[model samples]
Target: MSAPEIYEDGCPICKERLENGSDVVQIRQKGADGINAASVQRGDNVDVAAGCKAWLNEKFAPDLLETKQDVVDNMMLHLQNMDENLHKGHVGEPKSTIHQLELERLRFVLTSYLRSRLRKIEAYFPHLLDQQRNQTAEDPLRLSPDEYIFAEEYANNMSLYFRRVALRHMPTAQQKLDLSKTVAPPDLDAFVFLQVKDRQERVLIEEATDDQEEYVIDLEENSKHLMRYKPIAPLVSNGAVQLI
Candidate 1:
């Protein structure tokens, strides 16, 4: 996970202060009350909204401006062994044994780094592609503003993974051997089955609820629900629920 994998509640004031799209909220100071510096992103005092915001910046901000071309260029420079010419070593004048060994080691590092990023991209790309279709739905992916900013980066990563790596140097005749691996399904937003473990009143805006009344919902201990992620994120992070 690119974001902090971390979530609970107490007090009537805290319950009342719950923001839209959150189960709870609490005000926290940067550095106050004789407190030492700490990670502001994930903490006992931080709530869902704050967590999501920090998650976005950590996961996606750095690549917000990167494009598909940029990713491809990077892959070309660093994502080695994809090119057909990797086996055709020592094209130029022969170098000393030490120099050749160093070059080989450098190639290994570059290839490993590229592979690591690609794996991360693979894990995260499905979520991102699901967001970008822009189709209207009852339960959409919850993304912070900063996460929206990183949409392009997600697109670029997908392009590199699917178009570049999957299709690279492959002849058209035999390409059909395995095309399914390149496919990204749009079923990311389907209801997730979770085992809820806490008894807390939760609220969210939905068409099912007809009146302007805050419903007191107690997730029965050791019970399961097929629900969307918006209301379930905090629960999962706080160990109140587990995705099944």
Candidate 2:
């Protein structure tokens, strides 16, 4: 048997009347003959869309929730040890309180990461402008960035961001020979890339030089033991590292 259907209707931001434009989202049971016997579709506004639709997984899906719960579980394991040491009494520190605090901290970190990535993605990938626009309309609180416009709008409220990075690009044999002679190929350019995560993050410091321009790429250490990237091709070609 199919589950009962539900609907949620709200006035569009521009609509004071009953219907300026109404978005209809419905949840209906798939017929027995349907390929998937059990499935649901909800509206774009729904935390979980009830229907089969593209962007459903990205916008509203339970898979990420499951993964987040796994992270919370791992956090609790370390929090447990802290609690044992903090409370020396026979009645150990309250496990539930510690768990809740740890979960809250994890959620804050995850949300911040997602917001930063969403802004960067929107800035670099112009093709997503339409989707971002629709999302901003539906959810006014969504973190969408207008990099050019927002800079001026929030100019007084913003702080300058500066980074120093070290990057080494693997060069072709011929390019290496030119670089060795203090000459670099015209097509080659250098840039530093940083990836951020909970404990495991990478930082690269790089120097980019053009005929008339020289720039430094800034890299920071948020956590300890940043991985060192060996220049494999250059090292091998220059007989610095023996290749098997």
TM-score of 1: 0.28
Q: Model 1: per-residue lDDT, tens digit, 1-244?
A: 4432112232121222233455332324311211111112213232223222233322322121112233233334432422333334444422222224333544554444344335444455555445545646653334434444554576666566765666566887644532225544334344667666565455341434466564435677788777665555555545566555
Clashing pairs in 1: none
Local accuracy of candidate 2 as per-residue lDDT tens digits, 71-190? 333334433543553354334333333334433543454455344434443333332333335554333222233433443333222211111121123333422222112322112122
C-alpha lDDT (0 to 100) for residue 98 of candidate 1: 23
TM-scores for all predictions: 0.28, 0.21
The lDDT of each candidate is 0.41, 0.28
lDDT for model 1 comes to 0.41
Tell how far residue 28 is off in model 2, in angstroms: 49
Candidate 2 yields a Cα-based lDDT of 0.28
